[model samples]
Target: MVERVDEQDRVLAVVGRDEAVRRGWLHRIAVTVCRDREGRILVQRRSEHLARFPGHYEVASGGAVAVGESYEEAASRELAEELGVQAPVRFVVKFLNRNGLSPHWLAVHEAVLPGDPNPDPDKMMWHGWLSESELLRSMEENLFTPDSRDTLSHYFAAAERPSGQP
Candidate 1:
């Protein structure tokens, strides 16, 4: 078993070894899904040096929430660390893991920005605008993080519905 840690670095719960085998204890991660005025989502290519998910496209910016930090704080920190820009961010979704790949609760956010994105080469190597349709296709093709695909699907579905409708 593994102990899940909260934002304050406190142990929240003990999870089974099998559960940990897939994703381990639950952790919080911040994900930023920025959209341009054209309604295209920003995707990034992970650095080749990344230990995991190397050379794959992913959310605009993301990272694990630090101990003693809020989701917003983690989001902003990741953006600045990975994208080198500042913008307003709003909470859009919270994705809970059901597959046991990782005991992570994703805090997804949306950030609107002007002009093109300049990715930090240290963490990311490429950036591009992908429409929702294209993103779904990529997800089907296994081009993104497993957790990201789930969150994006939920976000896309919510966006397609009328306001205040679930």
Candidate 2:
């Protein structure tokens, strides 16, 4: 079962992923950004069989949270399921997705990959390690999913900000 969440991302109910999305419910999503030893980000090409944003590139590995699962729990599960690697996850931020296609709450997390990722064939077509500039170029060229595009921009912009500022 999937989690149906409130505006604050508090659990409101439980339902199937398809049904939750069909009803435009506010759900919790866990987005994980994995960096390589050289600090390049791992990006994935989504499989065509996926429900949303099929065949698009994603800079993060993630999915909706299940019922009774916390953001951290989902992040760990998704990281392993999609990339087959595990590392300590640092919580980043959360926001509401108001796009007509995916109305939900998104939680961002960061981790370091131990090595190259072994992507699930059913979840992704391939994976690549890209520098921040390359990732931004790809996004500007519209090669990434809407969610990934927004999340990457937000994450990178925040990472570049001065520490003392809010």
Each candidate structure's TM-score, on Cα atoms with residue i matched to residue i, is: 0.79, 0.90
For model 2, the superposed segments whose C-alpha errors exceed 4 Å read 161-166
Model 1 agreement with the true structure over 1-166: per-residue lDDT tens digits: 4346654545686655455446566766677889999989988888889766777777548777765667888888888778887888887766665432566777788888777766788778788888978876876775665567677776666667887775
Model 2 lDDT at residue 12: 78
lDDT agreement of model 1 with the native: 0.72
Please report how far candidate 1 places residue 65 from its true position, in Å: 0.9
Give the Å error, residue 158, model 1.
3.5
Which residue pairs clash within candidate 1?
20-24, 23-102, 26-103
Give per-residue lDDT, candidate 1, residue 100.
22
Worst 10 residues of 1 by lDDT: 1-10
* Per-model lDDT: 0.72, 0.83
